[model samples]
Target: MPDNFNFEAAPFDTLSEYERNLLRSALSVGYYVPGETLIEPGSTTLALYIVLKGVVEERGKDDQLFAHYGPDDLFDVRGLFAGQTRHAYRAVEESIVYELNAKMFHELCERNAPFASYFQASLAAKRQLARRDGQNLAEFILTRIAREHLLPAVEVSADLSLGEAARTQLEVGADALLVRLEGGFEGLGIVTRTDLMAAHFQRRLSDDTPVGTLAHQPLAVVELGDFLFDAMILMTRQRIERVVVRQGSQPVGLLHLTQVLSLFSTHSHVLALRIARAETLDELQRAAETLDTLIATLEGNGIRLRFIMQLVSALNEQLLARVFEQSVPAAFRSRCCLVVMGSEGRGEQLLKTDQDNALIHADDISSEDALTWMAHFNEALKGFGYPQCPGGVMASNALWCKSVSEWRHELQTAAQEGRPEQLLRLSILMDAYPVAGNEHWFSSIQAQLSTWSDQGERWLSDMALAALQFDTPLTLFGGLKTSGERLDIKRGGLFPIVHGARILALRKGLMVRGTLARLQVLGKHGVLDQHMADNLAETFELFVQLRLSQQLAGDRSGLRQGLDVSRLSRAERDLLRFSLHVVKKFKQTLGRQFHLDTR
Candidate 1:
């Protein structure tokens, strides 16, 4: 075996010393020129092919490109046991592959459970391996604050002169200095270069001027045990560039925003800062446009999709809140609450989709003024690249933007009528997450959803039926069914999970918005078996990730629901099949639970 071969990747990483030796003893290298066929379709897969050099193209029927493999990429493992290759492998360039003997590979699989499981595992197990495969960034994102290069605390006495503090900062090359206060101060104070510059401009920094006087107390601090990501969020939210790192009450070091940015190789903090500092519609719009860039950077860094969604959601909510604060009058703003519905409301939305928002104002407010403000807000979002919701789910719609009493009455009417349109609106509103203003009004409305579910089995059945409306995109023999070489991932995978989880949570009267959170709560309370809940959660994540990858690959106009099957790798195809099966099983569960057929 060549020492150059990467045993650190995936299934190879799980092999034991004995198993590795067994593999090494039987491994043989093969080379092929460009256009040479390595494995012909319908031929027996003699050995598992691991690409050691150059590119190998895996083509299906009609010579259509399925996927290509390069150095360190392996292929045809699924065919090894099946005894024949379903697709043809042609060398796109001069390629060298380390072929492992099929008989020895079978022996290794029999002896090593972990190694074999990678070739034949459920979506959940495969996902776990994928995470392990991405350990560098996966582990990087979960890195603790203490592990990063935190600046050591440069502390000065309360009586230290501004000139002396400046000297100390220069001597240590520190951006800020911590001041130890006298007279029973609760925490240490902080003074930055900005403060020194301000003091210099004011001519207030005499040699006798005390640094403590300029220092601000009650410093923002994070524990050493907290994740570096959490520290970044703290800095973003607090609008601070640096935070004091404390172990218990003792200040140990300072974590600057730059440190966090350096670690992730992303400007997510800078993006957040831009959004935070934006005071005009045009400024916010510019900031909103760069979100795709930030998301791409994060995704490319191998950060978990869930984390990317969460970070994007936070930035989005902030953008909305900023718009709200700027557009609405102070008096009216205090009287109304702004909410986002659908994907945005659930915090699972990655790239920008159509606007799904509503407004709820105090009944005493001027209706005309409220409507005008909401219309402006909607237009502002449109200007910011959030296309108007085709179904009129935005706050600009008078039906959606209503008073507390009016919304309650409207919901009750929907429940009573049990009409399809009304039920759809109810589901959309059910996902409402308050982004700005007095949230109590939104909560008052949200609290009534459980009671509305009690409008009897008829209402519940109607709501649950939507989950089963779309058929799973699978053939009779369990193969993936595609149209125009693209599958409606939203309809086939995402909708069933989202709607199923939504209906299930509603039935149990749980108020959580995100699909994963709803499943978690459901699982914990015995509504769904823990394992099934976990499977559903993972399946939902897989679908969202797939949809997001598709969205990111193309124009960022809106949700890209169609997944091009030819673009998927063999492993991805397997996972998709498994995930779809999980969806089918979940739909069956929902069917039985809600008695969908009878409806």
Candidate 2:
């Protein structure tokens, strides 16, 4: 292997040592200058080319650039397999590429199933393969209950005396004991340490009392194949310490919150605990400072990007809620609803960006009073690291902090006017998630908005069209167009996937918030085929991962929204190009579905 080459890159990464040796033995080098054509259209495939330095452009029959290959990037694999070239490869910059004979490449592919799959699989399949490759790094969180060792269940007959049940639990060193039902109930019930202590302290039962009288159904339960994270989420949501682990109809064991927490000591649970315990702004500020460190820790531990995004989002919501709780007066807080919009609303925010928030005050509350508290709330967030919204979309703005009736009127006006910008604002509001105060208020607004969207075809079409405003960074011939050294992954790839899904959800009357959840719901309802939904989900995740990697690497200097492609590894670049292609297909589908092309 060359000094610059790493195992994480493409076909080489999937190859066995023997196959890699075969590849290494057959390697040869070729160099080309800018505009020099390496393979002309309709030419026979002679070799597989892997760029060692500089850039290669693949141009289509129309002489339009479609794709670009940079250092450690591979090209011409499909052409080699087809035994002819469909497009021309030209040097975009002075470039050096390593060549391996097509015959040897064929032999290697024939010998290695994974190596062949890496080249021939769909983008979604490739992404799954990549995930599996790093499975060990993230397995503690993603692993299924069936894979982990479950604590043995300690069961006592419902008729057993409390003394006997307590002795059994103590003897078994179990934190909880199961009461097996005999006649009345069909399922077993669980009794925990707290339950036993509460019963004893309240003098509600005697030691001779039947255990059945004290037993109740478990707070939560998970099946054998369910991921640990699901169980953790349940425990977190319910404020419970453990959940019953079951296999089929039989009880397997218990999954304790402590077990999951022990595995992820640096998880969001710490932030959540801090938020819940914080009574003052100073303490919350101290807690907020740990967020960047938490993100860095989780990313370094190789947690899946989506899960990391969710964790960060959950933490952010807690931070915001705490700030709202501290900064807003109690009298006003109960009458108002605080919502987070944009990426934060969708639970896809991976970094602390601008504050996209609004307040929905009760009809009786004055807008002046709401704005005063909202200003304090917004300033508090700024002190905690969230910058003010550039477009003045924060709750502090008088226009945003409005009475319920006022917000309803604003939505009606925006939908009725049908201006492109107004529709765009309406789309942002569509993603709103209530983080603090009265959630019912926000839900009522959402219900109204859903009804309005159902009748607003022009509004939906305009929103969908906004997703296509930015041309995909990759040209028709597969070459990536860059703005200086930066490419805006957000606009080029993320927006189309997000807004397209949002539009689809609107038309279907689906109320889900996250992009992936919307796609899943759409797929479940047969609005989107499962394969296409999975492909889009994976593609969106890839774009998020790339942007996150860029942010985490401290590369946010010029063009804050752009990702510098030159800094990525060969495998990452390949995945990025494939992901971008997926985005292009997604946008084309959206345009056709929404009649954007005709408009």
Best by TM-score: 2
List TM-scores for all candidates, in order.
0.74, 0.86
> Residue 362 in candidate 2 has what lDDT?
92
Q: Which stretches of candidate 2 lie over 4 Å from their true place?
A: 1-8, 30-44, 53-70, 88-96, 128-135, 152-165, 177-191, 198-218, 247-251, 328-336, 419-421, 475-477, 524-531, 555-559
| Decoy 1 TM-score against native | 0.74
What tens-digit string does per-residue lDDT give for candidate 2 at 286-374? Answer: 98888888877777666777778777776777778878888788776778899999999999886678889999989998777788889
Residue 10 displacement in candidate 2 (angstroms) = 2.3
Question: Model 1, range 1-599, lDDT digits (tens) per residue?
Answer: 76666676777878888777778889999989999999999998889888878988888898777766766666798799788999999998998889988899899889988778888876678867655445676686799887356887888897898888888888998889999885433557899988987997776668678998988977888888888887877777667899988887677888888888876766777888888888899999999999988888777666777778777888888899999988899877779999999899998888878999999889997778888998999999999888899988999888888889899888888877888888888888878899999998888998898767777347877788888888899875456789978887788888988888888788778998798899999999998888889988888888877767667788566554588888875556667777888999999988888888676
Clash pairs for candidate 2: 65-477, 66-477, 66-478, 66-479, 67-477, 67-478, 67-479, 68-479
- Kindly report which residue stretches of model 1 are placed more than 4 angstroms away from their true locations once superposed: 1-103, 106-114, 117-122, 131-138, 147-224, 242-254, 415-417, 450-458
Model 1 collision count: 0
